[model samples]
Target: MMNYKIFIWMLIVPFVINGQNKISGNHSTQNLTCSTCHSCDIPTKENPCIKVCPRESMIRIDQPVTDAPKIFVINKIRETDIYSPVKFSHLAHAEMSGLAGGCRTCHHYNPPGNVIGCSDCHESSRKRTDISKPDLKGAYHQQCMNCHRAWSGSTDCTVCHELKGKEKSQTSVVSNNKKRIHPEIKTPDKISFAAKTKQGKLVTFYHNEHINLFSLECSDCHSNESCIKCHSTNKTASTKTISEKIKHKKCSSCHNTESNCSSCHSNSEAGGFNHKSVTGFDLSKFHSKLDCARCHTSKSGFKGLNNECKTCHGTWTLENFKHKSTGLVLDETHSELDCENCHKELSYSKPVCEDCHDDKSYPNNLPGKRAK
Candidate 1:
């Protein structure tokens, strides 16, 4: 009989202890649990339930099922924390997402309804290594930065998180709160300017020069992954030194060799060589119009002859070619037409009546032939 009583007492003692462990609403000191924080229904350890929730739904834990009349009840505070509530800028961050949509990326599955907060996963303190909370400072820094580094944005320490014990005063917070807030606006003037260059060099790059003058787009020199992966101030950084990696790759690769220069800047008169080359066309433009084979096919790419058009055309003597019979010479109108337009099957062939009089006017001198 005593043995039976001992077993019963053992079970009764556990129940009593658990009853004491139940959270009391009167004490506001303790943090709210996963179940208490949200207003949505949840399962206890005794009974577990699962359901597929839509992404848009806001499932709260403790929201009352039935509505009741409310009254204004302000309680007097005994002691309160001095720390000012952080004015979170989730909306500001959302505007800067670029490609990735805002808040959903970092604040992952948390509580009863699986809506999340940083504190849900990264607790303040932990006993076991497997279930340890990220220390307060570490938690805030890591969570804010890891996402920024992954996305195509700045992850500078000074950009977002304020250093520990350096929190702003409540008076400052109040002053800031009173000021009218506005929507996030991009730094428009800096669009053409690269913000931070290598070595604190402050290279004032004109993106408009490459984009408008050279007919290039943002993607021409930069890949999506390249922009995000490069120039990071984090441990997982893949590349550093923007000059060696980004700038050199874009500029020097094509501009380095001499052979490539003469494709449009040849010395031959036949190719329209300019004695006053500087005034005629810049070296950059000369490079733009050149054919690849004109340089690459030559034995030494640099030794290719002048590109002047007169050099080649001068060989075909003007005296050797003329309009026969009537002896009419081509005026400015015909002179500017492409050589192949009238030359037909043979490039040097004499212009026939049909060649110049395709409109049934000239040569025949019919009704429409006379100048109006």
Candidate 2:
């Protein structure tokens, strides 16, 4: 009887090994390498050596808040609870997410196509076998509580959920939430920072000028910021305790913070950025409407550029050039001449008419009527 039992156990071991191999083969059909899910090259069924979710490598789709549903009724989790479903204002949170990390703040593992919900990745039931990640209810509370706690300094259940019996009509709640949107963030025109520097103390930053004139987006600087940065319940949260490097990190991206200290820092509050005063290139005449990127093409921030027409407008000729747009329309005779005939210099400054007529000169003897 003992010999027969040993032979039977040997046969069952091979079948169990084949079943494990078959399970692994099914995973291979999905075109995933061992490293995709496992940390080790050879993972066993008992110890798969599964890697934790790599959020940084995950592909995320960022859509406008207008594309998302305005409201979401969270009812799947609290079916048997005393509270009714929470009417979550999706649009309101998405709009505020612009300052933060966008959709990745909540949807950490979002891939291409439709935005997935927390329940898709996290198991809805608490009795789930995989205990590595949080359950659906835990995920919902974790994501919401972090920001809500900072903003209000409280994580009360009633803050989001409405008690089943004491709640208002569901129709009214859904209708009110649909129209919900984040309040417009007021932008400052300028901010004067008191810096501790030997060169200067006051650093006057033209805030609106960077947005309107420089064409910088909010995310360029505020991408890594948390909800506490803006929505903190404590109004007395001072930035004075922040390190010097942290304070200059944002400006260092565009400006030479290491060497050019006096450019920003000054003994007194400095005026707005002056192109002519700083770079000797007056943009008010021709390049006022142009974007900063139109001229500053280098990835290492704006560098000194040659102030010559040929540097940018290399293709400009008598036939293609529009003189009327320059506020001076040339006459039939002058129009026929090449650009170098009057404007001898590459700078394209005031025209010298002495090359043709000895007595005649620009501003006195008009080539053509000044364009209206």
Best by lDDT: 2
The models' CA-based lDDT, in order, is 0.42, 0.81
Residue 125, model 1: lDDT of 46
Off by over 4 Å in 2: 1-33, 40-50, 62-67, 111-114, 178-180, 297-301
lDDT of 2 by residue, 263-283 (tens): 899999999989999989899
Residues 1-372, model 1: lDDT tens digits: 999999999998878667546755532344554344433454444332322223233333332212211211111221214332344444334333323322333443322333444554454544434333454445565666766566536666534434446767656744554442334433222222232424233333444544543445344454323224434546455644454445545544334433333332223222232324624423343345554444445543223345543333455434454433224556656645665665554424344447567665345542122222
Model 1 misplaced stretches (Cα beyond 4 Å): 1-82, 96-117, 124-137, 142-206, 209-243, 249-372
Q: Indicate the residue-level lDDT of 320 in model 1.
A: 52
Candidate 1 versus the native: TM-score? 0.28
Collision pairs in model 2: none
Residue-pair clash count for candidate 1: 28
**TM-score of each candidate?**
0.28, 0.83
